[model samples]
Target: MTPNDTKPSAVTVRGLVKHYGETRALDGVDLEVREGTVMGVLGPNGAGKTTLVRILSTLLTPDAGHATVAGYDVVRQPRQLRRVIGLTGQYASVDEKLPGWENLYLIGRLLDLPRKEARARADELLERFSLTEAARRPARTYSGGMRRRLDLAASMIGRPAVLYLDEPTTGLDPRTRNEVWDEVKAMVGDGVTVLLTTQYMEEAEQLASELTVVDRGKVIANGAVEELKAKVGGRTLRVRPADPLQLRPLAGMLDELGITGLAATTVDTGTGSLLVPVLSDEQLTAAVGAVTARGITISSITTELPSLDEVFLSLTGHRASAPQDARPADSREEVAV
Candidate 1:
């Protein structure tokens, strides 16, 4: 069964509303994060993605509706709720002056672990995150990736049942981002329920078992990654012309094919490439035939399912601005975490 098919939501929200004076940050939103799974909240800046995380983590109160984490009411039982949740914000929240080991150990002690146990846990996490050799060095000397891992390790001191990750990989490099993704997968394997808000579509595609896409403070779409992708009009047939001038010509040829549902969606990137939405093998075959018959030399041809970026564009009427082409996360390799 899929993650969403699991019973007993680790988090639940209903008609959650939060307003900043005349501006509504959250417009009667609702969401569910199933037990032992990652629920991705995907949106652009000012989409209220962080607001949702804040409410579920007991950092903010909704003006209307209710929310619960691990069966503890966020507003009514915040103290008890805090006991079961962990939060990692967009930026690293580590103490730069302290060594990585000391940072995590201090958190363990603050959580009331005994001195010996805190020391042991710190050692264990240092090794787990491959920071053992650098454990004694001050955090400011650590790399960006190392600092992120250290911050995550600090959050785990409590071994929270629910973890709130608010854009945890925002400014990290691809390798560092992959490391964080691996850590997230590890936590879910250990039965930690995760609620992650991110502007990276590939990040959501990589980590979330299911996604809730929010725009203007309301849920615009919710489903598994593939289910959401299917909403972008299915597989897209793409062609790169050998001659740069052939790009628009190829698009015109496809438009002249008179195929149903083909002309209106064709996109010319104005860079010797054409993207056409094709639903079936028949439509794909026809497009290829028409282009070749017109003597348009093709550099390369490919057909791919719609990406999360396309899905986001379709739902929100704008593409989520992401760094580095916004390609699929699966196309890249992860740093050994």
Candidate 2:
């Protein structure tokens, strides 16, 4: 189990609130990122994920609540907090006019490293991210993935204790995304704790052992990746009744079975079917037999493990509808204060 006793939170937040005008960008949010582990904050685009990252990175101050990174308060001890934390924002913040090597070197220098040490660190990271061949090329000449790697490498130049990655793989190709994932795994292995925010469901599942779902500027659900899935149900049993009229009754009957406790069965209005999430073969069998015993015919029946998309829908009462362009009011709360 990640975030187990063996590890304690390197970062902690309590009732962290931030507002952009009248909009509550973050509403009483609380979180924990265990030391040396990845805590994935998963939500739809414009779901206040970026705002949370900004506040944690000490770039923006919160309106209410408190946050600490490496035992330093974000508001009161921002300088110390900044020293122990790194941030890779949604878009690549690298200077396109500079080469990859220069970008990293500049960041290292800003961190107050000696000139030679900064140069060595920059080269080392270029090799680690497989950008050595293109290190001399300007950032604008680099590919999307390469620039992202450079941005990430720059964040790590100071060897910070905690890193905040806000949608780091948002626009990369699958291959490049996987490459970033490998680097993150390597960082965690080296005892660097990370707090990762992403809209991609697979990214959260693949990178973080612990996960939190943020929506409408609040933490809606949180647990281990498997724990959250299990909460929504690992396997969902889909049953389409031959008679639409039988849908509700069949759902009630299955719910009465208490195989998964109250509210376990949901009626899928679109297809007039009952979706009963089951944990075992026996529970699936019981629900099916109960429907048939009641003279209700099942038009189609199947069982499938719940996808993260489904989990998001179930928790938020809506599909994880992400916008491609500038976000609506809720998610684009990263206003400078």
Candidate 3:
């Protein structure tokens, strides 16, 4: 069985709602994160992604609805809930004044770990996160990736059953991002249920088994990765011309082949590529042959299922990671929290 099919929900949210004055941060959002798996909450800025994380993390009281993390009510049993949940927001919240090892040890102590156990845990995490060599150096001396890893280590110091990661890999390089992804997979392997909120489609696809997409304070879509991809016309032939300006013409040419659904959805302006539904190998071969026959040069060509970005755009009329006022909503969310 898939993760969502068999495991009970580690977290459950029913009719969740939160408003910031005139702005509806969350509008009756319903969600579930299966035990020992990652539930990706995907959305753009100002879409209330942070609001949902705040409520579930017990940092903010919802205006309406009920949520339970690890069987503890967010509002009614916040202290109990806090014991089982760990949060890592978009930016690292580590103490730059402290060394890496000290940060983990301090958080461990704060969680009531015994002095010996805290020290042991700190040593273990520093080694695990590849910070052992620089454990004694102040956090401000570490690289961006190092700082992020240190922050991640700090969150796991409590061995919490459920972790809330709110856009945790927002501004990292691809290598560092992959490192974080590996760490997330390792957490699930250890049976830690994770609620990951991110606006990056690639990140959502890489880490999450299932996704809940929030837009304008509502869950517009929620399903397995493949299920969401299927909704936006699955297995599309991504045809990118040598010249971006030729995209419309390429679509027109593809439509001439009479592929039933090719005409309606063609140009993904965001990527400047045409996505033609791939129904069968024979159809794809025919389409490729036609393009070659017409002598239309292509910069790239591939047949793949719909990406999470397309699925997201099809569900909500916005790009998942478009440029925006850098984390303004997040700052406001922290204030609200």
Full-model lDDT for every candidate = 0.85, 0.83, 0.84
Backbone clashes in model 2, listed as residue pairs? 46-331
Off by over 4 Å in 2: 1-3, 237-282, 285-304, 321-337
- Model 1, which residues run further than 4 Å from truth? 1-3, 238-256, 264-275, 279-303, 324-337
Better of 1 and 2 by lDDT: 1
Candidates in order, TM-scores: namely 0.82, 0.79, 0.82
**Model 3 regions more than 4 Å off:** 1-3, 234-303, 322-337
Candidate 2, TM-score vs. the true structure?
0.79
lDDT of 3 by residue, 81-196 (tens): 88788888787899999999899999999999999999999999999889999999999999878988998898899999999898888677878889999998998899999999
Model 2: number of backbone collisions: 1
Error of 2 at 88 (Å): 0.7
| Candidate 2 lDDT, 199-220, residue by residue in tens | 7778888888888998878999
Error of 3 at 73 (Å): 0.6
Residue-level lDDT of model 1, residues 1-337, one tens digit each, is 7646857889989999998787788998999889998999988777888888888888788899988889999999999888789999877899999999999999989888899999999999899888999999999999889999998988888889999998888778899999999999999999999999887888988999999999888999998898888765668777888887777667776787798666444656665568888887788888888777787678988888888888888899878867552345453312100
